[model samples]
Target chain A: MSALFEFCLRMGDNTLVLGHRVSEWCGHAPVLEEDIALANTALDLIGQTQMWLGLAADVEGQGRSADDLAFLRDAWDFRNLLLVEQPNGDFGVTMMRQFLFDAWHLGQLETLIDSADDRVSAIAQKAIKEVTYHFDRSSGLVIGLGDGSDESHARMQTALDLLWPFAGEGFEADATDLELAGAGIAPNPAGLRAAFDARVEQVLQRATLSLPESRFAHRGGRTGARHSEHLGHMLATMQVLQRSYPGATW
Target chain B: MTPIAQVWEWLDAVPDPEIPVISVTDLGIVRDVDWEDGTLIVTVTPTYSGCPATSVIAMDIETALRDHGVDRIAIRQQLAPPWTTDWLKPAARDKLKTYGIAPPQPAGGPESCPHCGSANVERISQFGSTPCKAQWRCRDCLEPFDYFKCI
Candidate 1:
């Protein structure tokens, strides 16, 4: 498989799975504006997955459409980071995950905008703009919930500790990632670690939430061989339509 | 350019559903407007992530151009090149500012109010009157206006 195509699938799968997770909050956000905001962001992210995976299908020369990649793949067959597949525990957990990932994603997109690869650059130029607002909104919520009142701060702090392990995988480089990073189509995940840390620290400190010292970085969730139990449960809902009726298009 | 191309040249006049003064082409939402195999194909990007108006825009494009008798018109929604206010034709920006909604600030920078020209607009809400826009109030104008939030 071409590294770039595989890379695209990896990226697309992360958004696809997590977007589904976030969409579950459509009618259930604590506030109405946030409900619409998260759902809208989910729509954008899923749309982005379709584009990247469609291109991935073309590159793989497998006649696999975006639907095939998204709906056909089993939990173990997905290549997304473990962090994205982690369960959305509560609003606090959701915002924590979103804030962490959005911060990294925004920075990554900013760097990708000028990628030597034209396709990556084009998508990044567009996606980065969207993620910028996404990051701001998510980070804003993280701060609000983390430092608002005693109850709010305690709940948010607990969410942060729960999610800390998964956050490490985002910064680690695997074999395929290193290869793609060398191609100049993607930035080195290792390089983004500092930027991600700094941004998160700023938000956490403002939220009066101390950073957890736990560094038992979770890894090896990609390569399509294994997944958290969360993936199987999420897929039950996500793939329901495609699994029931194959090739059904609107 | 074929007669279909000629028709496309005419369809270029279709104003954006939101920004009526500017054609969809100038807004960069209309990625491709052309004829293929006796069919007219038009591609558009949603103004933001989930602008419900995209379907309206597609239908509007077809209804507007159907008068020319194009057998089939397809509006392919491509989200790869996400829509940006920067894509707004310069002319459209001027029209937007004149029309009361602030134009998007240039990319790689923070946005400013289209009303009182202040960088001090605060985001009041993420969803505006439409999905593509966010509710931002100009601290200077003390007036709430929509920021053409990107997707």
Candidate 2:
């Protein structure tokens, strides 16, 4: 119920669900190197999710372990944004999703490093290097495809358009964010939006891809608890082991 | 021998989960295998921070240590001094090649095909089965192979 734990869940759950989604590409990625990278990046973020959520569970004293929080929770209980829950349609679509998230994540982490909440700040600082490289690799692909042949360019463009609406949730400030913002312990997503936009725009320009002029932006990804069908499938895979063999340890 | 020396000898045989021929010791990641105070402390540097194999690595190390009747084991991860390709033993390189996945090489700004020993290899995609490798293809051989991605 405390603001600190809630904020940590907001952060941790996002990575947890997204990492679960990415890890599905293991042994299935179009190429060997990509499979490794996707799975590894997924590993990195999922590891962080475990830490922050465990810390959150400890602080909350809710009798819930990190594993419980991760696997036992239902779709409505998950706090990840809808964008992360979207299915990996294709290589281009997955790259676009990653690029969009990376841009916003980079901005948030850049500010999070200065957060008064030192644990989150330290984690953010340590994670920055990894995310930066992830962004670079994703961005390179974005540009490469965006500027490539007509089919490739058009497909990436379509992916860009489809994923744009989900980007809005990363910038929305809720009561929890406002509370932590007051403590200088939470990142100001709204503040980071301008920078995120600038960085993403620059990359999009280099890619020579045009953003569709859609005035419509989707909201309620966090609070509404509505999600794509993809999330239920993801949770099914991720939650099975924990649910089946309760309290199983390493 | 002291417990430290004993632990090292015991650990020298633990094979990597993915790369079976290369022992953790041969990877230069098993920094210190010793008894500190009452517990066995095994220090390790990850080949890369998010190595999916790390959990397995830790599990393997713990199992190996405990199987030798050494309990109270703690695996401390050290990431401050980064890992490089140079840490892999020369024998491991040959082992990797024999296994069909080439060993890591310096980036040299571009990747080379591990199968045909040509510089004409190009990246096919960035996501591979694991984080430590990249999917590359040999233009000459037209064979897809894993490039031990540089950290």
Candidate 3:
């Protein structure tokens, strides 16, 4: 695939997988309100994936539709961030994961709004608005849960600790990102780290939570060379119906 | 007959797919209409970035124009200036209240029950049946309603 196609897939795959992860909580959220809120965010992310992947398919000069690209890809060929593929252990963990990703995503989208590519800029313009609300909702919940009762506070802290290491992967720019960044079609992922850290730290402070100091991290999802074991399981379920009844439609 | 004006009039009859009570023009999604090189072009913006209704709305706009004998039509999507609840017509707000959906309030503004006009209301959820609304309930009337949340 071309570098532009790869870059678009990276964007699309991240949102597609994360959207699926969030959608898993549709009926299982702690409260009815949260269930609705999380589902809405999921729909937004999934909708975004359609636009990105649709663009990617065109860039590749492939006849594949967005649905074909989404449903037919194997886990090993997927390029979503490691953090997005992580299991939703609890509501606290789920919110923490979302908060971290949203913070990074806000910076990414804001910078992308000025991209040299018009379509990318237009998509970013629309996406930043929705992502802003996602960040607000998740960050507010992080603070509330982190500063709440003893049990709630501890759970929130545990969630943060467990998810922190994976947060670094978001800032890792591979060959595709670096090429796009050089061409001004994409932002340098590294340039966004400081802003992401500042936002996360400020929220953690209000939540009475401390940032993890560990320097350990994992990578490789961007290149699609490897993925967490969780991805395979999720994809199995996500693509089962498609695999079973090829060309079926409602 | 003024064909361009008639096109706008036909567009005013196109009801929003989700909220059938208000027309797309009344909701302000229809930003501009003009004739260009023998083609009628209608510009629109989606209410939400990920709203599933955008394509449907675009199709509806075309069908509405075609039904009125307009041959060549071009529907354009513009995203530079984002859509906001502020664009909702004043008359549309009153219609929303009558539809049991509280119109969007100014940020941090007081919210009242649409059913009995009671200020004694509480938010049930930050989301409702549609992405644009939030769920709320009135303590006085004991009725649940959708609040058109501020974007």
Candidate lDDT values, in order? 0.78, 0.78, 0.88
lDDT of model 3, residue A130: 83
Provide DockQ values for all models, in the order shown.
Answer: 0.39, 0.27, 0.59
Regions of model 2 farther than 4 Å from truth: A23-45, A61-63, A89-92, A111-122, A125-130, A178-186, A213-216, A223-250, B1-6, B26-37, B43-50, B76-120, B138-145
Cα lDDT tens digits for candidate 3, A1-250: 7888888888899899999999999999988889999999998899889878988988988699899999998988798889999988999999999999899889999999999998888878878878988998999999999999999999999999999989998898778788899999999898899998899999999999988898577887877777889999999989999999999898
Per-residue lDDT, model 1, residue A68, is 90
Mark the regions of model 1 whose C-alpha exceeds 4 Å error after superposition.
B1-9, B12-23, B31-46, B49-66, B70-82, B89-122, B136-147
User: Which scores greater on TM-score, model 1 or model 3?
Assistant: 3
Q: Per-residue lDDT for A111-201 in model 1, tens only?
A: 8887888877877766776677788888888898887989889989998888888888777777777888888888888898888889899
For model 3, residues B1-151, the per-residue Cα lDDT tens digits are 2376787788889999999999898898888888888888899988876778888999998887788778889998787667878899889988888888898988632278989999999877766788788889999999988998887
| Ten residues in sequence with the least summed lDDT for candidate 3 chain A | A215-224
- Kindly provide the TM-score of model 1 when superposed on the true structure, using C-alpha atoms: 0.83
TM-score of each: 0.83, 0.78, 0.91
For this target, which candidate reaches the highest DockQ against the unseen true structure? Answer: 3
